[model samples]
Target chain A: MGKLKVLSVGALSTIQDEGRFGYRQFGIPQSGAMDISAMQNANHLVSNNPEWPVIETAIQGMKLEAIDETIISVTGAVVTLKINEHQVPMNASHQLQQGDILTISKPMGGVYFYLGIGGQLRANKDFGSYSTYIMAGFGGMEGRALKKGDILETQGGKPFKKHVIKQGTKPSMTETIRIMKGPEWKLLKDLPERTIFQVDPSSNRMGIRLIGDPLGIDGKEILSSAVIPGTIQLPPNGIPIVLMNDCQTTGGYPRIGKVVNEDMGRLSQLNPMHKLRLKIIPLEEALEKR
Target chain B: MNILKEKELPLLQFNKVSWDLFRLGEQSLLLQAPFDIPIEKIHDSAKLIKSVLGSLLTDIVPSYNSIALFHSFEESTIIEKLSTARGISQKKSTPIQKVEIPICYELGLDLEHVAEHSGISQDEVIDIHLNDTYRAILIGFTPGFIYMDGLDERLACPRKANPRKYLEFGSIGIGGEQTGIYSLASPGGWNIIGRTPLHLFDYKKQPPMSVEVGSEVSYVRITKQEFESWGS
Candidate 1:
């Protein structure tokens, strides 16, 4: 068995796998890794299954100490990685000794970081997922974010040869993202033809609020309906809200656009003050990208 | 049929309806019934797809007139299944269980506000709330938060102008034409009128939620002493 002790936690970090599935009808949000490819790349570095639980840290990073010898890798957004105050290479696995201190600092611009441990960390599986849905208080590390002194228990595995990620695989932190018309796309009246939006500070796992030219539409409280990640909804105030990984199962707001999965990944890594441009594309192309 | 032409569809006796299937996202598709189709048919179709798809489907979200299916590689299969679902009869050999909820009106903070807004007495509000048999149409917004219809128009009230930061768990409230109970405490804008003593949701149980979609729910007003004495 392996153990990892948390020394300091940043703004937000939680244990996540693919997500808690098969529970949306009950209104349980699917809490999963924001960027799928980045998470899998980190897992590949440590030779773990892509779906294995990993620590997802926000723009601000975390500090931890290994209580047992194991291998670890970090992915998503270029960040300063340190081991015992010495810089270490990211996107590559490194064997660690007991009591080795690991520190991850905020990225230059990215919003999410993933720490893929070599051994799988165990979490309470509610509805067959290891994700921490903090709103409901039910999964991952006792259903909340890791705090100082929180110890994570894991199944230990022998360290394999280091795995190195090829260059240029990581997605560039692009400002513009691709999107497609939503079910209620026609309702957008004053979309400001070519205006760019800035990510609002109120963004979180549930959804990201965008500050831009108001879509200039009033809502009549349409029948509550299903929504998913990448769904862009325009409320009565006309500000567009992009639903993310931890969004609710259903909503009543008017859906105006959907950021394609390829760009929802880009949207996920963006911090507040990041610029956003919606490049309207064919729905077929958006589905094809997946 | 254009949606703007209708105020709302009838409550019962809808037949031979067809739903339009639109791709929602990469892995999600929505089957929307025409405005003329009854709301109950929407739920029946959702139940059919949910049972048929089994593990192949992820989330099956049902709203007033549509069901959104989150599928993996079974898009064609889901389309095929939903296409044939209209002919399937909505029936059950087992009786649709009616879950009785115990509410303590004393615990609700907005009862007086709800009464004053409706220009009715507080007892009339409680009486009308208890008089109707609300059917659980769908579950969303939060875990186990059931969207129930069939509230009397006399008792209907709009949501609070300013939503509370945190509503107590099990707070029963009305939002627009619907009445619901919060399964989990969170910020909400509904006009709260009562509170239930039931946990309503427990993960360790066979089914986490006490109320399922298509369930018929009735309320029995209980005293605070009775609610406090109720065993887990």
Candidate 2:
């Protein structure tokens, strides 16, 4: 088995697989890698299953040392990568020998980036997932984000027979997120023809707080009901907040729209202060794209 | 006995996603029925839909009144199968199973407090709670946690001002008009009343969850001594 020693922990870093599904009934939110495309791309570079666990870093990257020789790939958000102070290109595979130090600088754009090792990242699994839920303090490394001086073990499985690296193809960085009208959209007061705005800097994996016109609906308390990942909730203050992987199982706010599943990934990658347009697409078209 | 009601039930649109499509992520979509329908109608519809679409779907999760059909986002055909199934309206003839749970008064840590808040006697609280049979409204939150409705209005309680640090497994609690059994020890705000000895969740089991949405749950009171024995 091989291992990686964390020398400098970034702002936010955690190990995540695809995510824990089929457990929402218990009030548990789905916590997984923020960017599915980046995670999948890293896995594809190493020819591992796309759902394999990988290290997800926020805007600021971290520094790590490979204890044993291993193959690794970095994907998601343009970031500077270096092996032993030697610059390495992003979105490509690299062979690191024993004692090789790897450093990922702050991302040039996008909020999160993924680092995937060829083999499984050794981490405890609870409730059928490696993702971390900071609020509940369960899953991933001791159920929390990685910290400085932490040592992570790797399964050190065999390397891929062929390394396939796909050159950089920037996804449309437009802040516009497409959503379908929610069940409670009618309950909103002073409903606007359009309420989408650019995502704010405070956004993280937990949720995206949109900077848009308030719905201006005032009402009494609502009955608690089920809330899915993409449900856009308008709190009493009227600002719409889109729930994500780490959202609560149930809420009592009126929702106006649910981001079609296809656009969630793009929404997840938006950097702070990035302007996003909200487009209303028919539910049938959204499902057709799926 | 009359099975159908005389009053006309409001017609609701049932939405279903088309098959042979992968819309958002790797998740296929199947809209089983409308939201906010009567509990009995939703339960019966979900049961019928599950039996009809059981073979095609794998993870079928029912909520307040809607059923979400999930499958690998990679499978394009799952969408088509779900939409096709949604177009058909068929009622299942299979009998629904009901499970009785044994609850101990000794574990009813908040029962006295709840009674005080509701201006009812402890004995009255117990009587009202056990008098009415409840229906499992949904199975969500954690794996195997059962949310049942039909609690006596007298016993309906709100969640704690702040969620408790940890709730014991199998702990029966009430929040607002809903009653539920906790399958795992996790943070909760529900007012705890008692506990059941039966395990609600076991990953090793085939179904993994013991109770399904739409099942009937009855609370059978047991003495403290019997609870102690059962605990052992």
Candidate 3:
């Protein structure tokens, strides 16, 4: 089996896959890679299945040492990559010899980075998912972030020819994202068409809190109802919170709308204080885009 | 005339309820019953929808008055299938899984505060809590967190002004008019009255949560020593 040891890690680096599913009814957050496409791309570069668990680092980068020869690739968020002392390119696979140190620095833009291996990382699987949910402590590397001295083993595989992904495939931080009206759309007095919402600095996997001109509406609390990723909720304060992968299964705020699935990946990559606009579209039109 | 009578009888007995369908997201739709409808009817409707959709649905999350259905089929297909399916039956199945949770009232951090606020003695508060049985209404907010109904209104207390940063698993508390147990350690604002020794959630088990919506829950008072010696 191929092995890699965590030499050092930055903030919030944990193992993530597509996400744990079919457990939201039990209140389990669908913990997974924030930027879904990036995780899939990283896996593809390493010739692994798109859903294979990968190390997801937030903001800052990490350091890993190859304990056994293996193939590795990095994707998501613009970050400087290195092997020992030599600079390397991202979105491309490289063969790592034993004892080689791989370094990834803080991202130049975006907030999350994904590092994938050529084969499945044999970590704890809870509810048929390898994704880590740190709050409850169940999945991936003892249900915690990657730390120094931690070792990860993968199913050994032969080195394959190197592969690289094309540019423009990575998600771009767009100013406007498309959305469809939610259940309580009528409760909204008006949509913020001219005003741009700023992403709150405290935003994390649970939801993206927006700082903008409060929509002056008598925001009444709805009975707790089901909420999924991308469901934009308007709290009593009128600031909207766009629910993400790790948001609670149910909430009491007025659901204004949900960002279309296609734009969700791009929305996740936006940094704090980033400007955002919502383009409300019909359900049929939104479906057509998909 | 015979066919019309048979069709009309089933619809009448079942109440032939209509639900408001809202498109929650690209892949999810929410069916909402009227507020006046019993939660049991809502649960039955969710079950009926799940049965009708079968494998087409990935999840069917039921709440007090709404059900969210997640699926990959077209919106029109789901709507069409739901309209043609048999109506939600009114048969009520009494929940038999009554879980007796042993609580240590000595561990209650807010016992004095709760007693003062409710104008009752501390011993009276514990007695009242243990007297009534509660039904699990909805489980959400966090993993395995059970939202139970049937708290005595006299014992109802406002949530803590500042929520605790960390509540141990099996921490039982009262928030507003509802009472609940923290299946996992989590930050919460409920007024803590006691804690249970049972590990309500075991990830290794097939169904991680032993109790679910509609399960009956009643608390039994135990001493701190008994709680400490629970597993042994």
TM-scores for candidates 1 onward, in order? 0.88, 0.79, 0.92
Model 3 C-alpha lDDT per residue in residues A105-177, reported as the tens digit of each score = 9887788889988888989999878888888886888888889999988995546668998644443454788
The C-alpha stretches of model 3 lying farther than 4 A from their native spots are A169-174, A288-290, B1-15, B88-96
Worst 10 contiguous positions by lDDT, candidate 1 chain B? B1-10
Candidate 1 at residue A10, lDDT? 76
Interface RMS for model 1: 5.1
Deviation in Å, model 1, residue B55 alpha carbon: 4.7
Best by DockQ: 1
Docking class of 3: acceptable
Whole-model Cα lDDT per candidate? 0.79, 0.72, 0.84
In terms of DockQ, which candidate is stronger, 1 or 2? 1
Highest-scoring model, lDDT: 3
Question: Over the full model, what C-alpha lDDT does candidate 2 score relative to the true structure?
Answer: 0.72
List TM-scores of chain B, every candidate. 0.85, 0.80, 0.86
**DockQ metric, candidate 2:** 0.17
lDDT of 2 by residue, A155-246 (tens): 75666455656644554555567777665555667544455466777887768897877777757344555566787888888878888888
Error of 1 at A245 (Å): 0.8
